[model samples]
Target chain A: MTAYALLVEYDGAGLVGWQRQSNGLSVQEAIETAATSLNGGATPLATAAGRTDAGVHAEGQVVHLDLAADLPPARLRAALDFHLRPQRIAIRAACLAPEGWSPRFSAARRHYRFRILNRPAKPALEEGRVWHVPLPLDAAAMHDAAQALLGKHDFSAFRAASCQAEHAIRTLDRLDVTRVGEEVVIHASARSFLHHQIRNLAGTLHMVGLGRRPVSWPRELLEGRDRRRAGQTAPPEGLVFLGVDYDPPLPWVTSDRA
Target chain B: MTAYALLVEYDGAGLVGWQRQSNGLSVQEAIETAATSLNGGATPLATAAGRTDAGVHAEGQVVHLDLAADLPPARLRAALDFHLRPQRIAIRAACLAPEGWSPRFSAARRHYRFRILNRPAKPALEEGRVWHVPLPLDAAAMHDAAQALLGKHDFSAFRAASCQAEHAIRTLDRLDVTRVGEEVVIHASARSFLHHQIRNLAGTLHMVGLGRRPVSWPRELLEGRDRRRAGQTAPPEGLVFLGVDYDPPLPWVTSDRA
Candidate 1:
């Protein structure tokens, strides 16, 4: 079996998240099905650096999988992409991998972006792709308040009710909220996240945007892991996995399994 | 009669150009009907900076029209925008114009943009927004060749077969082509354009991009002037009227019935 990694980009609207599902279509299912056809009956299992939520998008999602053949690296990537050409997702880059490489565990820091478009008109074209926030937000105030939530914290209050992590403690390396024209971009980086953590944080930060809650809302939520104490979970549509980091030179290792 | 200058933006995918017609919808008819309904009596006629062809978009299209009442500049713009809300077109700015401010006669120069998405994908989300040209393109060569056609020249070769312009002589102030990742943006500016001039230029330059035509295509086209000798007209989807330029406090016209 060859362990390889691949870089991916996708519009998440049509996907049932990244995992395999019996009832709905998923990125994994699509890739595996395409791989089955491309490899001439060899079935491959695809794993991702992050199993993004159903409506979440990705510009640089990383994945790794084991292929049964020692096929040339380029052919593996090319054939899978060729078969999966019709799909919305794209395998931008791919390469061979070292043995035992796991897209999830090998990832060090994951970057995510949440977009909030604050305007009155219901985004006609950009709708369903971003959060159409109708309220007037004070970006400066929201930014100043977001600083307190930086660094390590218990993050229990902002934790989701369905999170599977054993501990709610995590270090938030950064949180940036800024406005450009009618759109507000929230850039956040972390080692990893508990389930729904980013969405939950986005929800509470929105309150600060509206000036409903003080800037301390985020730090307060981090101090309290009680899910009930946190703001509502932000919509999944606006979140996008920007990319992942890896030790390079031996190729991306993030093979395009499909 | 009140004179009003309107700033408009629109996605021109559905309408059959900006003018009125019996066959199909035009942006002019939509706005005129919408404004007439708001007037409660007199019918209003709308005029635009450029009477764009079908599938041609505009980000800043200026126009001067007559209204029945003396509405404040901001209020008039706001009301017209609110009334034309349902249409794909949007009125970004509006105000009473200085007397005799004609969108066509008063305009000094016009700017247009063409976007070529050089990618394999058919661009599902941006369906009617960009033109997808899958093959790789050479931006520098296209730009270099494009520079040869700048300034005053008889562009008979780039003129459409049905173009109504009496003369082929026109000065091209600028022509810039640049590649950003998978998209190539071409920006062109001039006093006016012969019908299909930009589209024809794009087609000829595209040949240069693919190394199919010599790098002197632009100069060759400028000298040829024969419509039959030019390149094919590119699809209208990729073209946009960036804006129109005028001297002074932005076109405050005093009379509409003059």
Candidate 2:
């Protein structure tokens, strides 16, 4: 058996998140089905660094799966991409994995970007890819408020009720908010995230950006540790899984076969 | 009667071209229908600066129309936008046009951008918004070759066969190509263009970027003055009408009611 890692990108619209469920089609099921076809009837389980929710897009998602056939990385990637055709998914690259490497548990950080179209008119070009807020937002104030949530803390106030994680304690390495033209962009990085943590944070910061809450609001919510007191969870359409960073770095593989 | 100008933005995925046609829904038809309803059954003809082809997007298209009702600019804009819902079009701003103003005739320059996704993987998020080219391209080479087509010249080589322009001579103001990460971006500007000129130039420059043609090939094609000698017309999906420039600048109007 050969362990391989694949870099994936997908549009999460109309998808049932990353996990396989009987409810609807999923990113995991789609990739696994394609990989199984290539493995000639043997099903291979694929594990990703993050199991993104439905309507959440990804630019650089990492996945690991073991295949019985030891095909060249380029050939396997091309074949898998071919089978996954007509679906909104692409295998950016594939490479032989280091022995015992895990895409989910490998020691490193993950990054996400949340986009908000802060304009009066509804989005045309960026529909389904951004959270449209007709009201003007103060990005600088949001960035100031986001600073209070950085570092280690019990983020229970921002954790989803359905989150299965045992503990709400996590370290947030970065949270930045900036305006790029009509879009308010927020970048967040951490070792891992509890379910809906970024969305919750984005929602809470939005209130601050709109001047509905003071800059001290996020810190107060963190200390209170009450989920109901926090703002509404921002919609999933705006969140994107940017990429993952692995410690000691995995071998960089080129998609070019030549 | 009020002569009004609207700044428009739209996603060109489903609509026909800007012109009104009997076969399919066009951007012009969508706006006109909405405006006519607001005008109480009287149809208002809309004229745009550029007649963008089907599947071509626009960031800042200027349009002029005359309405019988003399409503406030912001209220009129809001009403039009409210009626334009469920369609992939937005009225960015609306204002009273100066007397005798024409969107097409009074334009000083027009800007367009073409995007090429230079990567091995097919696009997932940007699928229909960019042209995917699997082969590696040298953006610098493309830019270098494009410099030869600058200034006034007979550009019959790049004009489409069906182009109805009386003369093939046009003064090209700017044609620049640059690489942005995994995408190659080309920006072009001119007072006017012959049909399919930018696409043809892009396709020809693509050959130079691929090292398939010498850097001097664009100049040779231009001097040859043969439409058949030029490269294929790049697809419409990759092109965007950036905006139009009017000299003696029109008054800037804000969409905000306050």
Candidate 3:
């Protein structure tokens, strides 16, 4: 069997997100079904770098799977894309990976972005792609408050109650808040994240941006280690899994295999 | 009655065109209904600078309406926005206009933009906002061919059959094509246009971009003045009415009325 990595993009509006669930269709189930068809009815398990929640989009989600069929990466990508049509998903790129490479564990960093439409009028063009906050937000204040959460710390205050991680300690590489025209943008990067961590952070920062919380509130929440003390979790629609980075980065295969 | 001007934005996915129609709900009818609610049940007429076709979006569509209620511009704007809730439309701005001002007649220029997703994948997030063209396109070739239709001409070749314009002669001010990442953007400007003129021009230019037709084909179509020989009229989903410009410039009232 050959191991392959696929770069995928999807609109998470209607799907049940990145994991396989009994409630509805999921990104994982859809892709595995398409791959199973190409593999002559044998199901191949596809593992993603991030199991994003429902209504959370992805621009460059990475997935890995093993296939018995020895097909060129380009043809595989094209075929998978064809089978995935009429759905809001695309296989952007596919490549052969080094043996035993894992998309979930081989990553060094993961990036995410959250968008807030900071305007009085509701969005017409970007309705579901953004969090509509009718009140004005101070981006600079939010940026200042976000700096308090950097580096290794116990992020229990921001962790979801259902998170499966063993510990709440994680290193946040970056957290930035900025305003571009009428939208407030938040970018975050880390080695990994707990369930609803980024969304919780965004919600807390939103309070600081609105002047309801002091600049030191995020730091206080971290010290308190109480999830209830943190702000409400931001909606999943505004969150996007940007991409992932790997140490000794996987050599992307661009040309067709002979 | 006080004459007022409004800057409006809307998503045209489910609504009819700007004009009132018996078949479906129109943008004009929606705004008029909201305005009439503020004017004590008397339906006010809303005239738009550009009567965009069905599924055509607008970012800054200029509109004029007269109301019997002497309300502040801010209050009027807020009331209309409140009543337009759950609808994919917004009143971006409102101001008192000079008496006798007409959105359709006093306009000096109209601006429009068309978006094409030039990629192999169908859009997930921007599904209805852009035209998905899977083939690779040469933006430079398209831009070069568009220059042929810049000057004044009798554009019978590009005019739609149902167009009610008295004359086919119109001056084209701008037609620019540029590639932005995976999308090809086309911007067109003119004092006025015949029905489906821009879409037809886009369709013709698309052929030139694909090397299906020579760069000189647009000029040849213009000279021939035969509508049947030109390319098909492009879909309305990709077209956007950006805004309009007034010659003397309408003085926008900023302060709230006493």
Candidate 4:
């Protein structure tokens, strides 16, 4: 048996998120189905570093699965991708796993980017890909206020109502907001996040950027440890899983040279 | 009556080019209908700087229309944009034209951009926005070869079969190719272009970048003055009308303060 690590990118529109659900089609089911087809109708377990929500995009998502038969990394990627055809999922790279590496547990960090189209006109090319805010935002003020949430803290105020995490404590390494042309991009990196932590943070910061809420509002809400004290959760459409980082690196990186 | 110059942007995915067609919806028809509704059901003429092909996007398209009632520039833009809702079009700005300014005739230069996704896997986010070439391409070689077609010369080799131009002679201002990460971007600028000229040039440059054709091949094809000697026209999906320049700047530039 071979444990293979795969790098994935996908458009999460119309998807039922990363986990398999009875509600609709999912990115996990798509990959598992493709992997099953490649394994000659045998089902394979496909686990990702993070189970993203529906309408959330990903540029560099990591997943790990075990196969009964060994195949060349290139062939494995090619075959799985071929099977994933017509879907918005792509296996960017694949290679043998390092020891007993698991995407969810072994992941050191996860990165996310949320895009906001801060313009009056409706977004056309970036229709479903961005959160359109007709009002202009102050990116500099938002960035400054975002620093208050840095380091380890109990992020209960930002947690989703249905989050299943036992503890709400997590270290937020970075939260950056910058204006790229007419769009405001927010980048967040952390060990892990609560169900809707990033989106809630985004929504709260947007209020500060718009001057409706004070810069000290987030820290006060964090002190309260109450979800009701924070702003609304930003929509899922603007969020994207940028990538995941693992310790000791994976063979998918070096396999390209070989 | 006032001849207003309008700055426009559109996503041409389901559009039937810039001109009105009986078969399907066009950007021109959308704007004309919107203007007619705004003008109390009286149809108005909407002339564009260039009639882009179907599936050809535009970032800064220019258009001119004569309105019976002279309204404030802001109101005109707001009203037209309000009416153009539910369509993949945006009136970026609107202002009175400079005397007898016409979008096509008074335009000094037109700029276009073509995108090529060079990768092994199919692009998800940029699926229809770019031409996916599942092979390695040398962008520097393409850029070096593209310079051979710069300046004025007869370009029948790159003209479309149904091009309705009186002469094949045109002054080529610039043709530049650059690599942006995994994508190859081609920027073309000229006073005007023969139909499908940029697409054909991009296809020819792709051959040069792939090492299938020599760098000097474009110059040879130019000298031949035969359409059969050049490469095939690139798909319209990869093409975008960047913008058009006029001698006296459009009123939107000066009307911003007022």
* Winning model by DockQ: 2
Q: For each of the candidates, what fraction of the native contacts does it recover?
A: 0.02, 0.56, 0.47, 0.35
Clashing pairs in 4: none
lDDT per residue (tens digit) for residues A1-258 in model 4: 788999998999999899999999999999998988667679999999999999999988999888887888878888887888889888888888888788989989999999998876667777789998877789998998899999999999999999999999999999999999879999999989999999999999999989999888888888899999888889999999998888877767312333
Give the per-residue lDDT digits (tens) of candidate 4, residues B116-172. 988777787777899988778899999989898899999999999899999889988
| Per-candidate DockQ vs. reference | 0.20, 0.71, 0.45, 0.46
Using TM-score as the measure, which candidate wins?
2
lDDT comparing candidate 2 with the true structure? 0.91
Best by lDDT, which number? 2
lDDT (10s digit) by residue, model 1, range A1-258 = 677677777778878889887768888887788777645587788899899988788887888767777776666666666677777776656777777677888777889998887754344335557886766778887787778888888888877777788998889887889998768888888888878888888888889889899988777767766789878899999899998876653374223234
Residue B202's C-alpha lDDT in candidate 1? 92
In model 1, how large is the Cα lDDT of residue A237? Answer: 91
Q: Model 3: per-residue lDDT, tens digit, A114-168?
A: 9998877778778888998878899999999999999999999999999999999
lDDT of 2 by residue, B1-258 (tens): 789999889998898979998889899999998999667689899999999888999988999988988888887788888889989898888888988889999999999999999988888889988988878899999999999999999999999888989999999999999999989999999999999999999999999988999999999999999989888899999999999999877675656546
Better of 1 and 4 by lDDT: 4
User: Worst lDDT window (10 residues) for model 3 chain B?
Assistant: B249-258
Error of 1 at B138 (Å): 2.6
Worst 10 residues of 1 chain B by lDDT: B249-258
Q: List the residue pairs that clash in candidate 3.
A: none
Stretches off by above 4 angstroms in model 1 are: A1-4, A20-24, A41-43, A68-82, A118-125, A134-136, A226-232, A249-258, B1-3, B20-25, B41-43, B63-65, B69-89, B119-127, B249-258
Which of candidates 2 and 3 is the stronger one according to TM-score?
2
